[model samples]
Target: MTPPHATPVGPDLPMPFTHAGVDQLVSIWLAQLDVIRDLAEELTAEQWAAASPCPGWSAGDVVAHVLALESELHGAPLTDHEPDWAALPHITSDFGRLTERAVDWYRTKGQDVVVAELIEITAWRRDDLAHAWNADSDPNEVVTGPLGLELPRERLIRTRILDTWVHEQDIRTAIGIPGGLRSDAAWVCAGQFAFGLPYVWGKKAAAPIGATLDLTVTGPGVSFERLVQINENGRAEFIERTATPATVSLTLDWPTYAAASAGRLNSDSTGALVANSCRGDDQLAARLMPALAVTP
Candidate 1:
């Protein structure tokens, strides 16, 4: 059940990647954290228990997940905790189980406690990030991210912004207070997800070579038109213009685009498919839609 109020437009497509400095990205990440903190602080006990879009996670659990990650980033020591996997069937991957350990630890505490921890941890993270990097810093400088992955400094922060914004939306949707769909963080997150469409079409969906798919995202904030063609090398790439007609064309709103790209539309409960208008080759569109989720 996608909320009726969730249909807000995002910023234009192809975000200013080259110009987005580390400081700016951190600011966006901080803004997302502020939104999440506010949402968590106002939640009632019953609302905290509400089921979120994330499998087996309550609204409070989502906050806890955010808090846990930030706490780790803030240099908090990891607790010796392991969830009983047999009792948690919703966890289907090693990564899920790993993240669940921290989330489950907070489940033993009160909701207010979780909110307080989130506030404290996020505040600390904000201060640390302010001093850690700056606009003039090398964006390509390698930094460690979660799971021991080494990523460029800018990419690591952008990933945090995307994750924080998405989780904020999860909390908002769970408690029926949908918003933050048009924030700066929202646009960044949307663009990051949209950037993955090439991989989805090329490798995941396996669109036929020489076929072109036109994707138009209608947004008041995060809107963009893209034409992706499978080139002779059997690779999908975005092109500025094309003379050949598209084999498939898909139009969707920003919210629907984000939801689908985030893998939230895979469940029938989201009702997100109803919002997408597809044309041209039906078979190709079918293949593409299922492969749209580029996030793990």
Candidate 2:
């Protein structure tokens, strides 16, 4: 259960979107968009069926999820006029139809039309989110999910930012986009991801008191927490952080960290992690190796 306004990670301080932050967010947004746009350039019936990072989800399912979320944020389907209960099957069936129609439409139309359709959806998503978030609302409004938490407006916006960022990666990887993420979106898009640390780590502390961990990335953009990740078998992990009093610290370049979270590193170079501030780099890296299979 998610609180209507509950912050994703936890209640960390909110920072105003600086000029640099805004630029990074846009870059991330557009870069992901570019990948999807580029892929739409030449998707065959089979490519659309390719598997994504997420289990049981293909490129098509990922796109459907995006459309569902964006539509939910500001459309009648998720309207305030609903009965106080989630229309579970109804929602799934409805969106299922949407996805089927979209795929059929993709198969039916010219490449130009497909691009136009995606552009329209993205434009609408941007407009709706901007309108809802940019407005003045009580930060403590009852917008939380069933989770007993309430996040401010900025925090909610961060989720949308993340959805776009991560899902784009889903699409990119499916199409075999080379290299790491081209934009500084990781920095810009991580507020919500960072907000989830407490929830992800829970009350568990992996590091000793006053331990030092440094997280650095070679990217040109604003700074936010880098994306947080946990390993597949649930032992290894990656987190965005610097040396400080905390548990489990690791360091990697921003894009590499992001790509590392995806699966492997770009330069075949592994990152360093200090576990209990005791394990050697190789061992620490060994610990964090399996989180790449995480689904969004």
Candidate 3:
């Protein structure tokens, strides 16, 4: 909620955060755990390996990713967090146990830093966004996260919420959890990324050479703005967006939007999402589809 890292318009958009945004994110965060619990109740080892929205990953990989992150949360000492240990062992057994060691490490952050701490790191991580959107800063800049370019903290929280909720749905969908995307978390979780499609797809080339496009959501929620890159880089920025929307609206449900953001959903599968936009002209959204379609 402080000033965003930077801003120069790429597409026609809205402000990134609001108070409701926090609630939406929190809802998704909590819902992720609840749904994962449901998955545990309904699924088995065989089912865990079922394919997920993520192209190469299965339900097991998804679980491994979540559990691995939790393991990190508990302060597991990583020789290198880069290529996560999830990819280490050829067999699943070693993979599971090594990460379990990561989890055990968190239990004792100070007392040997492994078993004695015994703290629930998820709750602690949740606290990072408590006041994220508390500001009404007039001009926000894009900040960097641990990895890529950083979004405003507030927007970042929304994406996190969106990520948790959407992946939860992916797991649920794989295991036959009914009524996916039923909560407020689904709307904000999905919408948060939809609004910022332009920023994430900044480097891609647009299909439409000279066209204006927009990605307005079909349902409710006041508009928030962000920009996109439309034309080739190094040309005048405004002229570029006028040629095409480097940014486009994401209008599908929580599951599809999440999958699309992860780079999994093809355009055919995303229904009613860009219902009003110029399809051929909005290459940014689709170009970004690969990353959003899976968990990277």
Q: Using lDDT as the measure, which candidate wins?
A: 1
Q: Which residue runs of candidate 1 sit more than 4 Å off their true CA positions?
A: 1-13, 267-276
Q: Could you tell me the lDDT of residue 9 within candidate 3?
A: 20
Clashes of 2: 26
1-296 per-residue lDDT for model 1 (tens digits): 11132333322334544357777777888888888899999999999999998899999999999898888888888878877789889999888988899899898888988988888987898899888888888989998876567999888888888888888878888999867777888777866876787888888878889888788778645666777888899998887656677888888877777777877665552334533488787777777886887677
10 residues in a row with least lDDT, candidate 3: 110-119
Model 2 off-target regions past 4 Å?
1-42, 76-120, 135-151, 179-184, 190-205, 219-249, 259-296
Model 3 Cα lDDT, one tens digit per residue, 58-125: 56555544544544433454533233345445335544454444333332232222211212444544
Query: CA lDDT of 73 in candidate 1?
Result: 80
In what order do the candidates fall by TM-score, top score first?
1, 2, 3
Alpha-carbon shift of residue 283 in model 1 (angstroms): 1.8
**lDDT of candidate 2 over 47-159, digit per residue (tens):** 66677765445676566555545445445243222221243232345434443443333434444554565666667755654555433444345564211235654444444
Native-to-model Cα distance after best TM-score fit, residue 261 in candidate 2, in Å: 5.2
What are the models' TM-scores? 0.91, 0.53, 0.52
Q: Pick the candidate with the highest TM-score.
A: 1
lDDT value, residue 123 of candidate 1: 85
